[model samples]
Target: MKISTTSSVLALAAASTGSAQTTTYTNQSAPFTLQIANSANASLNGLYLFSCHAGAAIEGICVGGSTPISGASSTFYYNTTDTDVSGSDDGQGLLVWNLPVSGLPGTDHVSQSAALQPYRPGTNVVVPLFGFDAGTPVHFDDDKLTIKDYYNDANYVAGQFPDSTPAETVYNNWYSCWTGVGGGYTYEALSWVTAGVPHNPTCEKIDVIRTFL
Candidate 1:
């Protein structure tokens, strides 16, 4: 059952920089749904490291939620970096990505301040996201790649050993928003998170890498 794919991304309007790019979420699944609880969420592939064999020339990772444009999709870049991700965990300082979904039109919580204070914890909201390799294959500048899932799965109880804590008590499901670079989980590249509110039937399907170019 071989099928053809197209670039699901777009060369979003730019000022004609030294390069170009497109991004998308692939729809190879049975139209799934992910519920990123208040402090817990995740993606399908569980990919921590994102890479782009888009030549040596660096490019920027463009991540625009329901807004027109926010980050650079042509100059910023990161590829093959490592990310230790889980299915749960949402912490402060976590950069989440936002894409439009079909059943879930209209996105929310779009701000244009570099202060990084979109809103109070749990103030913002979004629908489920469909992962993809939109448009063409190229390098992105990734100034803010923290836009991945709800936060890394911090299911592990934080405490001292020996006089230890109970690990068999709670069936934990999530973690925090630790960077994939150092400290917590180590990812190989860049990534983003697509989450929706709690108990809400929010589902969406944006441009997936319909067919790989």
Candidate 2:
């Protein structure tokens, strides 16, 4: 959904006074793609983020080429409406997907809303869970375009955590991990892992970059 004009005016006013307000104005530099930076694999570098099903668990987020999933769109734009009732910017904004999800498959269940939530209860890994109509206002660092939760302030990572089968490994960090289910094989999940947690493979910190067209 688009940001309200009134909200834009407020943002401008707050910005003028150097007060924190939801800044919707990308200064005409929006309509950008999010890229995962500092990835261990060179191929994953500069690739855009997209939505995908995390093996029937939930409609989750993934990162890779333009079309990481069968009918998912990687392009996204900022929705700077003040979602926080506190009326503070604090780097709050919605990462709205460019495409509509009405016609996507039932299994896909993609929503424009880009939300970072737990894949399930009692798990360290935080998965990007979408489907909110108003869209959750994620803590979007305008300078970095990096998504962070307000609670821990941890940077989202693309994990290569091990799978249950031992021999098989999943690119995403979901607990019930398996491989070769999604359309793209190497499309990794966007997650947040607790610091100092041990894993066979470490999660790579991802940076979201803005791109034109």
Candidate 3:
């Protein structure tokens, strides 16, 4: 499994520059509850996840869960990414995207000084990766959080790798925060450990993406 630290592909997703984004509260799987909440001070726009079955198309299915975003907090179903993916058909992956909250009290766009932090509801714990400023040594919470779940759709089409590639699982938990200029963001690969159930064998690492958005 190959993971790239670039939002170049996700920049083409269906999202506006400064618009209100609608989100649905849904249960991810067992023991794991997906909470998408904007901070009180920060204006969060939207968080998007794209998945796919084959090719560079962002489409797939999330197996297991409950109704209306209320369920357990365990590792179960997995998210996916889009077309352009030319790897072994190892189920699906996720491309995570986050936009700033729209309509603030002042200013057109929130600067790093006034950036908001996204978090899981109730606990009031700030998520590690999604931030606008540099609180941690490494940061990706600057302007946007866009990710596409695929390795080499272009390379696959270019005959670089075989179609029947071996299927493997990969995890990515790094992000980039905004600087000042448009499309200008710094990269930061966060370091953390995984608890609860092991995110392998059964492909039960869906909590990584849904917890923020």
Candidate 4:
């Protein structure tokens, strides 16, 4: 599945399904591999993975800290956490968003469309995670995943800061370019929304196959 927005386009591809899928259970550790194609023509710096299950949206568990995404394609791994124990009990669906590389302050550079698939732990495969064909292009300057929403909706918290605080407001003001603190304010502003904004999740791809790394 893919979606196109006014300013940008997003993409996703199909994967395997049903009994061919294996569940990753609690207390088990495994590495899940993913690959992304940068059709947006922008360099990405991070990846935000989310899990949708039980009528609630939760942050998915990814082991390694994010790295830069560039070139025709990029590969990364979900190296952290016990997948089965962490995902929602009702269902295990995964969605992905790309964070573009930017130096602008108050610019929440997140993808607008999401790449989705069912969770199958212990599978190592190269999945064409996201791009312009599946979803809308991300607009960091406009579509924002607010810090308050992050705290209110998901289990992940922004740093050690309280879910909602005056500091967060200030940080968002500066991050969203509502203030004139300038580009140097990146670090301090980031302190406010530590988990960062997510994509709109307007698209999905099913039956994705797990590739062996």
TM-score for all predictions? 0.19, 0.50, 0.19, 0.20
- Colliding pairs, model 2: none
- Residue 23, model 2: lDDT of 42
Best by lDDT: 2
Q: Candidate 3: what lDDT?
A: 0.24
Residues 117-210 of candidate 2: C-alpha lDDT, one tens digit per residue: 5344454555455433234445444435544432431333468443333331112222211222223343356665543452315356555555
Worst 10 residues of 3 by lDDT: 20-29
Q: Alpha-carbon error at 149 in model 1, in Å?
A: 8.7
Highest TM-score model number: 2
lDDT of 1 by residue, 1-213 (tens): 111122121111111110221111111112111112222233423222211122112221222222222222211112221231221222112111222222212422111111121122542322111122122211111221123222333454567333234332211212222222211223222222223332212221122111111
Worst 10 residues of 2 by lDDT: 168-177
lDDT of each: 0.21, 0.44, 0.24, 0.23
Candidate 3 C-alpha lDDT tens digits along 1-213: 122222433232222221211121111112222222342312221222222121131112122223322211121232222331432223332222222223333322221111123332332212232222322221112212222232434335553556566443243332211111112222111112222332222221122234431
Cα lDDT for residue 77, candidate 4: 23
